[model samples]
Target: EPEVTQTPSHQVTQMGQEVILRCVPISNHLYFYWYRQILGQKVEFLVSFYNNEISEKSEIFDDQFSVERPDGSNFTLKIRSTKLEDSAMYFCASTRALGLASAQYFGPGTRLTVL
Candidate 1:
């Protein structure tokens, strides 16, 4: 079965460094999103992308963060300046349908650790 794959399940980085987390979303899926969960916090939406543009973004998606669809299958999230608070599990998700009918499928997650 097709599934989203995220690379480097865990990463440790120094503060203020740029980091790129990669994910390959399910084939034929149209909508994509990035969410993060702190060790004890609820999952928070960072951004959602469709049609090569951002559909919706949360306050957490600040200038230091960006996302891109480098190709037909690969989606990536880049943090230009990492902070200690950036440590969390970043999940990549996708859905074939839209609106309330669509169910998002998530990856295991890339655990970003900033020190």
Candidate 2:
């Protein structure tokens, strides 16, 4: 079975530094998303991408955040300036389609720590 995979299981960076988180979603899935969970908080949606363009995004995805599908297999999220509040477990997820019935496959997540 195929699954989403994230790189650099953990990342430590200084505040104001840039960080790019990478993910390879299931090969056959068509929609991809980025989400983050602050320590003990609920998972929050950041952005969604499909057809090589941003489909939707939440308010948390501000000017500092960007998403890209640079190639066939990789999806990435770049945080232009890391902040203390940006430290969280960032998750990558994908689904074959967009609907209530479609189940999303999630990656293990990449933990980001800002100092």
Candidate 3:
């Protein structure tokens, strides 16, 4: 089975430094997305990307967050400035089809911790 992969399984950064989280989705998957889960909260959607453009984004994906598919197989999320509250597990997901009914495969996640 195909699965998504993330780098720097764990990250510890200062409160204001920039951080880039990377992901590689299963081959042939098209739709890509980013989601985060705070320590004690449910997973929240951040942004969705397709055909090199953002398809949908949540308010949480403010000016500070950005996503890109720098290569054919790799997708990345960059945070311009980290905040203490930004500490959480960020997940990368991908699906073959579009819309609410498609199934998405998620990466194990990158845990970002700010101090």
Candidate 4:
């Protein structure tokens, strides 16, 4: 079976430094999303990218963050400046459909460790 892999090299970052975690989801999926889970908390929606633009984002995604698809195969979440509280497990997913008719698919998650 094909496995999901996270490029941790892209996640290494220092506080106040820009960091990006790259995710490559299934090609046929049309909607891309990022969700986070703190060590002791429930999952939270961070942002959604569609049609080459951010279609929806949560309060957690502020001016310091951005999401983009630089190419057909990669979806990225960038933090302009890192903060200690930013540490968490970030999950990336994609779906060919949306809402009720859509089946969601997830990629391997990358953890963010802020110092």
Candidate 5:
């Protein structure tokens, strides 16, 4: 079975630095999304991308955050000027379609740590 994979399983950075999290969604999926869980909090949607453009985004995805497809197989999330609150497990998910019946496949997540 195909699955989403993230790079650098764990990332540590300074509070003012920038970080780029990478993901490779299932080869056949069409829709992609970015979500984050801040420690013990619930999973929060950040943004969704389809057809190479942002389909939707949550308030949490402020100017400091950006998403890009970059190429045919890669999806990425970039966080500028990282903050302490930015430390979380960022997840990448993909689905073939959007609907209640479509299941989203999630990646293991990339743990980001800010100091």
Candidate 6:
């Protein structure tokens, strides 16, 4: 079965630096999303992308953040200026369909530690 893969399971960066979290979502999936879990907090949706543009984005998706589908299989999240509060587990997810409650397949997650 196809599964989501994330690179650099853990990263440590200084404040104000840039970071790019990489993800390869499951093949044949159409919807891609980014969600972050801050330690013990709940998973919060950052953004959802489809058809090349952002389909939806939460309030947490601010000016410093961006996402892209560089190719057919690769999805990337870029943080222009990271802050200490940005430290968290960044998860990439995808679903074969999009609806009221389509279950998403999540990657193991990339832990971003901003110092």
Each prediction's TM-score versus the true structure: 0.97, 0.97, 0.97, 0.90, 0.97, 0.96
Residue 102's lDDT within candidate 1 is 92
Q: With candidate 6 superimposed using the best TM-score fit, by how many Å does residue 65's alpha carbon deviate from the native?
A: 0.3
Better by TM-score, candidate 4 or 1: 1
- Choose the strongest candidate by lDDT: 2
lDDT of 5 at 29: 91
Measured on C-alpha atoms, candidate 5 has an lDDT of 0.95
Clashes of 2: 0
Question: What lDDT score goes with residue 59 in model 4?
Answer: 99
Error of 6 at 46 (Å): 0.3
13-61, model 5: which lDDT tens digit per residue?
9999999999999998999999999998999999999999999999999
lDDT of each: 0.96, 0.97, 0.95, 0.83, 0.95, 0.95
CA lDDT for candidate 2: 0.97
Candidate 6 residue-wise lDDT, 7-47, digit = tens: 88999999999999999999888999999999999999999
Model 3: how far residue 54 lies from native, Å: 0.6
Q: How far off is residue 84 in model 5, in Å?
A: 0.7
Model 3 residue runs over 4 Å out of place are none
Residue-by-residue lDDT tens digits, candidate 1, 1-115: 8899998799999999999999999999999999999999999999999989999999999999999998999999999999999999999999998667898999999999999
lDDT: which is higher, 2 or 4?
2
Sequence-dependent TM-score of model 4:
0.90
Please provide, for model 3 over 26-107, each residue's C-alpha lDDT reduced to its tens digit, 9 standing for 90 to 100: 8898899999999999999999999999999999999999999998999999999999999999999999876678889999
The deviation in Å at residue 98 for candidate 4 is 4.0
Clashes of 5: 0
After aligning candidate 3 to the native by TM-score, how far in Å is the CA of 101 from where it should be?
3.0
Instruction: Provide the lDDT at 110 for model 6.
Output: 99
Lowest lDDT 10-mer window, candidate 1? 94-103
